[model samples]
Target: MSLLFVLAFLVGPPAVLLTVIGPPIRGWPTTDQLRAWLQQPLTEETLTAGLAIGAWLIWLLVAYTVAVRIIIRLRATTAWLRRMPLPTPLQATASGMAGAAVFGITTNTVTTTPPEPPQPVATGTAAFHDETAPKDHRDPAAREDGVTVAGGWLPWEVAEQVTAAAALVWLRRRRDYQPHPTHPDDTDLTPLPPTVTAVQAALADAPTTPPSDRTAALLEALPIGGLGLTGPGALSVGRGLLVTAVLAGQRHSPTTLIVTRATLVLLLGPAGETLGRRLPLTIVDTVDEAAQPLQPAGPAAEEFSPGQRPDEPSSGPNHQTIVLLNEHDGDEEQLTRLAATGTATAALVVVLGERPDGPNWHANSTGHLHDPHHPNMPTPRLCVLDQTAATDLLTVIASPDPAPPGLASERPPLPNAGPPKLSLPRQVARREPPHLSTPPRQRLHLRVLGDPQLLIDGEPLTIRRSAGLQVLVYLAIHPNGADTAQLTDAIWPGLPRHSLTGRLYTALSELRSTIRTASDLPVVNHSDDRYRLNPAHIDVDLWQLHATIHQAAANLTHTTTAWQAVLNAYTADLATTRTWPWLDPHREATRRRIIDLCAALAEKEPDPHRALQLLQDGIRIDPYNAELHRQVSWASTELQPWDRLTNNHG
Candidate 1:
């Protein structure tokens, strides 16, 4: 009701008042009156009475009602157009205009007519069949001559309507029509593959409704791997179209984009700068360069390189959302992981030109530009983008801020081809380029004995962050994963949740990455709260050491070899760094287990010399333990007789 009042009072009056005010100024309607209703020559009294605010307002209300009815009629006409067969372009246009005009003139254009009386049946129809009447009565020529009606050309509307009705009846009869199946040998019957651009264009211009410019909503509503952009990277026009689509998508967000193709980033960097946007893009130009960040960097560099580019300055921007722009060799696995991880972390991927073996929004100029390796596959959701869209996207890439920096555009690395695919069992097998492909996942070797050390393929692996290693160690100790809150408390205590959350992800990524480098298997997995190490491929020495001790203790008849294995498993005190008070319980438990094993072995051994040796070793580990000291004294006493007898014999 309130909206009605606003529109009725505010909107209606201005348009109506223009008529009364316009005549005296520029002079329209030529005759000083609005219609033929004026009684005498135009005068102030007459004009004032006719143009009274209430009277004019009433007229406007009537016009509004008429307009509503006209709109309904127009909608009906549009419906009719959809069902009707195509007419000549000239006739179609003319009919459309005429229909709309008639509909506007009055709302009651549609009417029902009474059925016409049935034509009289032929006289003596039974006699004619029995040959009782004239035989000519049965002939068609004779029956038509009885009326002798002269025919005339039908009106255009009647003719068109009859023809349309006939066509509709014919169409309905064949509504279930299907094309005949082709012969097996008929190669010509094979379907032609549709290009991505053609498919997308059809979608863009589909006539069900008007095209929407709600591009922002379209982007956010997309599911992971639900959208992609493909075009000839060689064509500048195609490049612009893709770049535009990406920037336009990010317009409503601050999400990271992990671009795998360098050519795309190269095109985007300058375009972004030109558009006044300064995107937070990280360039991993090569595979070797990509892993370098996973490995250790300088202390200062490592400190500042969490969830960001390492080369970035300390005070420079460290954005949460970044674009990974490059299709580096052997990045198929990395990109796949990135797509999933980024999505989990609120990052989005936009593929340019390259056809990733996944479903997404594909934008391409032609089908030929598609990846030859995936020749038979089709990109159903692909859309065609033109130069205009590209230009608009460039504008969108620029930052909304008024001021932009004066930095030179950074050129990105060109894409390098990996080893060719070889067909195996109807699937193309791809090989990664040597430098770009990270090692396949295998069993991990973790040493948490004295100082934490990581070994990959028997070589000392460099660690980038201590926190990540700590997370691994903590998870290793805890077979079941810990929640983020518990991990934060254990790994990065006393830190704010927001700050710690990002750091935790960064650390986790680094750890998982290094684990992949040394051992192809991911060492850790997290769902909601808990993050756990996979027991299958990860071998933690501390875990093994405990197992060894249990097996040795459980054996009823212990062998010297069993005791030796237990001792071998324990290289040093549990975890050398003793800064954490949390380690106290584990440290105490391990020490006590070793002492008990040594003492038990000493008492059970038959050799007095070996017994002395076991007791002394136990004493070395725990000199203050009274039982070990006593055992050592007893062993020495037992050996005294043997020493005296040996001297007497000599």
Candidate 2:
């Protein structure tokens, strides 16, 4: 395509010239005659030839103008395509299914029963809400099977991304605001596992709005894990399919998968035994065991009963209980009875082969499912994971759950310190104060607490390539550096590793060159196959915020000033508008810390008006925090009756 443009640009003018001044075989002027006509002064023949030449020149100009316009349009389209995440239906479904799985595991509402509203704490400082906590916009949708986002079907990937992102946020909030007791003994110091972090990075730019009804329906209709497979290698493929479904189903809810022992080994190989024990899955011996009343798998799951959450109808899709049975194990009579019982209990019965009483979709080795009754219909492809992929996924699911960033000090009120004191402790010492007043003019400025921007000596330096900016952001997040594999996986998730090596190098080179040209410093340092930003040469705002937070913790004598410094340092949410796939967890973690900071500071403030203002600021940051709202109410009550009414109404 570019060659065609070059040909048109370079060849068109010469062709026109040859046509205008070639030998007179076709009534065209000879070169000598054209020269004579140009040399002549104001003759009619000269004017006619000149006009003819001028017309050709004008034609060439018009062609070039149209070509330029077309080039611009093509470039614009190419950039748009690069920015658009979902380009295929299969990828969309993968994202949605993965998102749903993430949602299931990370949802905050995880209890056997609907919890009552939170009452005030005994100390009267601030009462944290339990299950009755004011829900965020996406919390309800996250609990359901389908997550809806605003807009048409075109942005359904955004819907899925939003679901995954909301789950992550809820998970973090739960860890921060409402720690669950289900895994009381489970403790891992790391903020999040690699799989969860990758998923968070994959869906970082999801819209803040909750999914819309139309979008939710569209997502629900996605044929993620098809009903059943019965082709040549149907059982093998079906195992992967069923396993995928189980993973997705049990993630956020207390869902269970009941499979026979033989079928479990066939599905997950030797790992099945370990998985069955670890996951909320039950491996049964025969059809008789399958028919027995099943237990709730996880903390949120409840036994399928008559009365639980009376407001919610029994028919509603509250939770899932899937039963996987082999054709050989169950007789026709038992299978029929089990199918009926499954329907009554809102359970799904999946058979290994074509069952007369079950949903039997045939699948080929390629993972596309076909309805035997309607062969002419379009085949929906199932999300089939091979042994390796499925095992890896299960391993991630089995990994230790996360603990919130700062779990040790998660109380609502600030610690009991009388006031800022003048004396400094023997062990405590203060470093030089951070440059909080203004951004340093002479040094490199890397600001990612808002929109990512790199400024050299106070002047904006654009990193022309998106990948280049991504490299910078990745390095900013991991100051210690990242190897080639980590960088590729985080930046380009599912792309072939071999194919991305060159592109990765180019992005890195471009980043280094751009920074070097602007600042005359090697911003990116490569050592031992790992790439990181040169911390000595550059000053990142995120790092500054971290320092401020640490200082606040150490310097208790200057409590008020220190807390305010932390707030001021956090200019905005980390990388505000930019939605890099890997930024969501980091962003949410920082946001939660800030909210905690505000609440703690407000609790310590002695002045009623000042305390109210502090709590209000925290509310602005996180409006749905029921604890913050309750604190606001408590603070308002401390004022005089008239002031209280004015504050409440205002």
Candidate 3:
């Protein structure tokens, strides 16, 4: 207070002196004159000067306080960044320089042109002071085109550059850093192994808004569904095909989820990019839409354009799916209708919004969508054998056939197995041959020559007994199928009719259940006392082998690749643990045909060595078959005409 009083007295006197703009007084003023001046009302010049000085001082005090606070905060922020688990940004310098360069280029501030005389240099380079140039002198055309005025350096330009550099460093660190997976013990993520952990960390780093400056890690982590589910291998359709293959043993027509248009846009292009653009996703809106049957009137999936990124690849027509945007009502009648009828050809996948308002389509298991409203929900997103949650209820239906505590088999044991010792020979569970490289999504892949095995999605099934497996094989061979009596006679020829019926029923039931669990489809279908594999759900290698061999035999237009494919198909004989007696007859017939076909192929082949190779392959498949050995011997004995002629000349 004392210092301020002294300073105020000195400052006021000087300021008052300056306002009395006149010749300096030669002598001290008289006491009476000074008293008279003080007594009179203060002049406007003196009052104005006093107010200006006081205002300036107040502003100085406020500015100093703010600067102190800012410095304190900056130090704290630096410490926080240093302690973060992610790196503190090696790319900050490069990023800042790039950004500044872009800004300068856009504003016409970065140039080689020299500034006016008395030019000051920054960093030893001639500094270009753009402010001196008149607004009209700068490219008037470009200025009109929304180019912001870059009139040299602003008071805080340097500070702004420093702050921006800091921000960019933090952003890069966050984008690239993968948080340790919190829910490592999640059951759904178990099958994914290391891929699950990686994908989870990526999802954590990807901000829901997906800023333009997001690092490469975030961009790579973005889901393919964001590319608008077009072309071959679109995640929605690919997963749908995988589902179809699992359920029906075929990836024919895909299943599609009619997404509301607003939600659909988030998965695609730049709605998220445009600042201040809020997607119209709300709980109330969804509830209102899901209540009624969706007519899907807004726009077909055609409204969706290809991905905006130049590097993103365009997919094919097969990947083009029509999901109706903004079409559902609160009751979720669209999904309910789809689930009830099962008539819709394509499966539905909810890509962008909250789960359907109603309970009809509740089982979702699929990918990470950038939901704008709940940008930072901290929960572990999970998928079964994949990266995202599945939206299909049918997917959950694939849950392992209900295992109860100390569970017993539903059907009784096969009647023929002798007593307590030979009762349940539990070796029928089939696992895929380690050699075949098929993905889990492919249903019903078979490998039978060395060890007869049935694989559903690369996982093998084991039938409890050889007889039950034989029944499945027999049914596979004859598509038209067999009557109960025929199957009974085939399995138990001398047994009584009643006993055969009991045993057959038990075996058939167990086999059906096994196929259902493995392929998610019924392999054996019984109708009007006749049994056969459900035509739509079976893919036997034996069938392929027969077709390929026949194709080779009918070489009306022959090609080397085709013959090679034929020989490849016939490389192995049928069934290793020959349980079914019925297969032997057909197996023999097929082997003879393949041997004859191979011999014919060899006869037609131009190269004697290739022909010998084919003959050798044929012998290897059926070594003991006299005809195959005989054909091999004949092929070996027969010599080319050139060799015969050379011998005669000798």
Best by lDDT: 2
Off by over 4 Å in 3: 1-442, 556-559, 627-631, 644-650
Better of 2 and 3 by lDDT: 2
Clashes of each: 28, 10, 44
lDDT of 2 by residue, 1-650 (tens): 98697668667766766776642235777899878867876898666667766866776787788789889889968855644333245445656766665676668567554433333223211121221111211222232212111110112323343335335544545343521111112222233334334333433433344433332222122222213448865665555445444544544354567788877777678877777666567778887789786432342234234454311223344335667877777788877776656555555666777665645777676455677665675564444445554554455455234555775434444334443222211221223335677864357878887788998877778877767777887777777788999887766554457757877888878778877776676678899999977776787887777677656655655556886797789888878777555666566656666665565555556666777887788777667666677667766765678586787999
CA-lDDT, candidates in order: 0.46, 0.57, 0.41
Consecutive 10-residue window with the lowest summed lDDT within model 2: 145-154
Residue-wise lDDT of candidate 1 within 113-150, one digit each (tens)? 43343343333221221111112111221221111001
Residue 245 in candidate 3 has what lDDT?
24
Estimate the TM-score for candidate 1.
Answer: 0.31
Estimate the TM-score of every prediction: 0.31, 0.52, 0.30
After superposition, which runs of candidate 2 have C-alpha atoms over 4 Å from their true positions?
Answer: 1-175, 178-228, 231-323, 336-349, 354-361, 371-375, 386-443, 457-459, 494-499, 516-519, 528-530, 535-537, 554-558, 592-650
| Pairs of residues at least 3 apart in sequence or in different chains that clash in candidate 2 | 104-251, 104-252, 105-251, 105-252, 148-211, 148-212, 149-211, 149-212, 201-581, 201-582
Q: lDDT tens digits, residues 378-440, model 3?
A: 221112222132221122323232335542222212222221111111112223434546653
